[model samples]
Target: MTIALRRRLLAEFTGTALLVTAVVGSGIMATTLSPDDVGLQLLENSVATAFALGALILIFGPVSGAHLNPVVSVADWFLGRSAGTGLTGRDLAGYVAAQTLGAIGGSILANLMFDLAAVDFAAKDRAAGHLWLGEVVATTGLILLIFALARSGRAPVAPAAVGAYIGAAYWFTSSTSFANPAVTIGRAFTDTFAGISPASVPGFVAAQLVGLAVGICLLTALHPDAGTAADQVVAPTGERDPVLGHRP
Candidate 1:
């Protein structure tokens, strides 16, 4: 593998790991702090997650576009394929693998931090139809918002915007807006406040995929030339260096 691709992969892995750490870690902390009130726990969790997400984006946006979500990476690849501006097929595969593994690692790390067993394998069942529908809506809105910002020359604000949307989605969407397949899988490894049952993963993932398709269709309708801006999705990182495929 080329050095540039390797660096991007490393960024993806580390960024995703830290993002999940914020999520699972904060959830664990919130529950401990607000053991008596689910509302307060959620409030704390949402706040921490929103802040961490925005900060992580700013820290890693210059590399790999900080696409901590697999759907976001996939969307970038699909939209930029015609223009040759986004992730190549190999990059996509590498990114997904890195992000997924990073997520699992983050979950394990979070558990360890809390003095809990590693790989707890969450038992919280969330197999309701309403939750599945929530995932679809949450994922659709997230994808649409990210691409919309890029298409409208507003990529710079994506860090805050994406974070705020997710924070709001936590309360508005019944599923708390997992919206990410890698995250979904990672959360399953913990039985904490932020974890989901392994048995429910397939339904959520399926719903997210459906949301992905819907979001892309909506984006094309709204911005017929959105593909041209694929490289700027989530955030702008400038032209890739000839040798590193990253901004110098």
Candidate 2:
């Protein structure tokens, strides 16, 4: 692997790890602080997640576009294939692997931090048709928001916008917006407030995939040339040409 690609992969791994850490860790803390009120626990968890997500994006946006989510990476690859501007097939594979591993590690780390078993598999059963629908809606909206910002020359605001949308989706969506497949898998490692049961992973992933398809279709209809701006999804990276302001 080239030095640049390796750096990008490292960024992906670390960024995703930290993002998951924020999620799982904050959830643990929230439950401790608000043990009696599920509502307050969710409020704290969602707020922390939103802030952490935006900060992580700013910290790693220059590297690997801070995708931090498999669905986002896949969407970037598919959307940019024709334009030759987003992740290549090899990069996509590497990113997904890194993200998944990072997520698991983050979950383990969160458990360890809370004096809990490091590898406790989550027992939170989230299987239900209504929850599946929520996942679909959440993922679809996430995809649309990220790409819309890119396509509209509003990429700079993505950190805040994306974060805010997720924060809001937490209350609005039935599934609390676990729109990321890697995150879902990671959350399965903990039985905490933020975790999901492993048995429900396949269904959530399938719903997310469906959401991706729907989001892509809507994005294309709204911005017929959206592919040309695929590299800007989430945010522009350091990989772009310094002179021309885009990938060459």
Candidate 3:
């Protein structure tokens, strides 16, 4: 691989690993700190996730667009498909693989840090039409927020804005805003407060994909002239790509 592509892949891997570490790690800590108070635990988990996500984006946006989410990467490719100027197919595959592996590795690391068994299958069965709908809503909002910032040339504010949106969605959405497919998969490896069962992953992923489609349609209708997308969800620095920056 070229040096630039390698750097981007490394950024995606490391950024995603850290993001999941914050998420699963905080959830573990929250449960320990507030054994009986689910509300308090959720609050702690959401706040940590929000802050960590924002920070990760800021740290890695310039290097790799800090996608940290497979759906976001896929959306970028799809948006730029007509022009073929955004993430190439190879980049897409590499990014998704790195994110997925990083997610699993993060989960394992979090579990080990808490003295818990690594690769514990999550028992939380987040199944139900309403909860699935919540996933759809959460994912939809996430994608909309991400591309909306890029389309509007407001990429710099994405870190804070996306973080804020996720924090809010945690309370507003039934699924606690597990809007990311890689995250969803990672959570399945841990039987923690933030986890979903493996059986439920497909449904959640399906919902997220549907939400992605909705977000893209909305983005196109809202900003037909939007030429490129941003590297990070909320905050991209440096040059922007026609669909997402092509900065090497």
Candidate 4:
């Protein structure tokens, strides 16, 4: 019941809420504004999501690691257990709960803001082996990017690197890179272009978990002694996040 833990949970909740808000909100706007151009709609949605995510990471990276994603939280916990520098099991539970609830709230907020029903289920059916493959690849790449930066002592670059990778994955992956279980669950509540059907959610989540396993294995193989710093996933406190052409 420390204040720091509370702050971390709050940051995770608020940060995740904003991230999902940008995602579902922008998707709704894109479909409405560019009804005829699917490509353009995707572009708009991806850009908004990318920028919003980077900003959220930069703003909250020092607190709660800005995990925003449950898998990231769990991955950090698992990876840092031996090093004693990651989230405790209790912290993991709190963070996952906050993220999941925040994601749902974000979806509801987006729907309400756009005058849509608060709990309308998505009708977009995104099922298929190939699409699942895309989810696996997308999630795997995401984990790789985060941990890779941490291993190489380049974690300060993670905000931009993660954002850029996701922006690009939206175009490269057939599934548009949902890549996140919390996000996938939240998007199921909306019937917008960004939404996924409830039926498809379980499969997508399973694929993401598989991808997580693969990413963990790859990290161990590549850097068995990777540092257990918080910045492995989110930026640390007081750092500038290296924006404005400082990527490397």
Q: TM-score of each candidate?
A: 0.94, 0.95, 0.91, 0.92
Candidates ranked by lDDT: 1, 2, 4, 3
Tens digit per residue, CA lDDT, model 1, 67-103:
9999999999998888777788999999999999989
Give the TM-score ranking, best first: 2, 1, 4, 3
Better of 1 and 3 by lDDT: 1
Writing each residue's lDDT as its tens digit, candidate 3 over 1-248 gives 12388888898889888888899999999999999999999999999999999899889887788889998888888786775445779989999999999999899889999999989999989878888888889888888888888877888888898889989999999888888899889889999888889999998989888888887888788876443653334455345455654754
Residue 191 in model 1: shift from native, Å?
Answer: 0.9
**lDDT for each candidate structure:** 0.91, 0.90, 0.84, 0.86
- Tens digits of lDDT, candidate 4, 84-115: 86778999999999999889889999999999
Q: What is candidate 4's local distance difference test score?
A: 0.86
Top of the candidates by lDDT: 1
Q: Which stretches of candidate 2 lie over 4 Å from their true place?
A: 1-3, 239-248
Model 2 reaches what TM-score against the true structure?
A: 0.95
What is the alpha-carbon lDDT of model 3 when measured against the actual structure?
A: 0.84
Instruction: Name the TM-score of candidate 3.
Output: 0.91
Q: Is candidate 2 or candidate 3 better by TM-score?
A: 2
List candidate 1 stretches off by more than 4 Å.
1-3, 238-248
Better of 2 and 4 by TM-score: 2
Worst 10 residues of 1 by lDDT: 1-10
lDDT minimum window of 10 residues, candidate 2: 1-10
**What's the C-alpha lDDT at position 83 in model 1?**
79
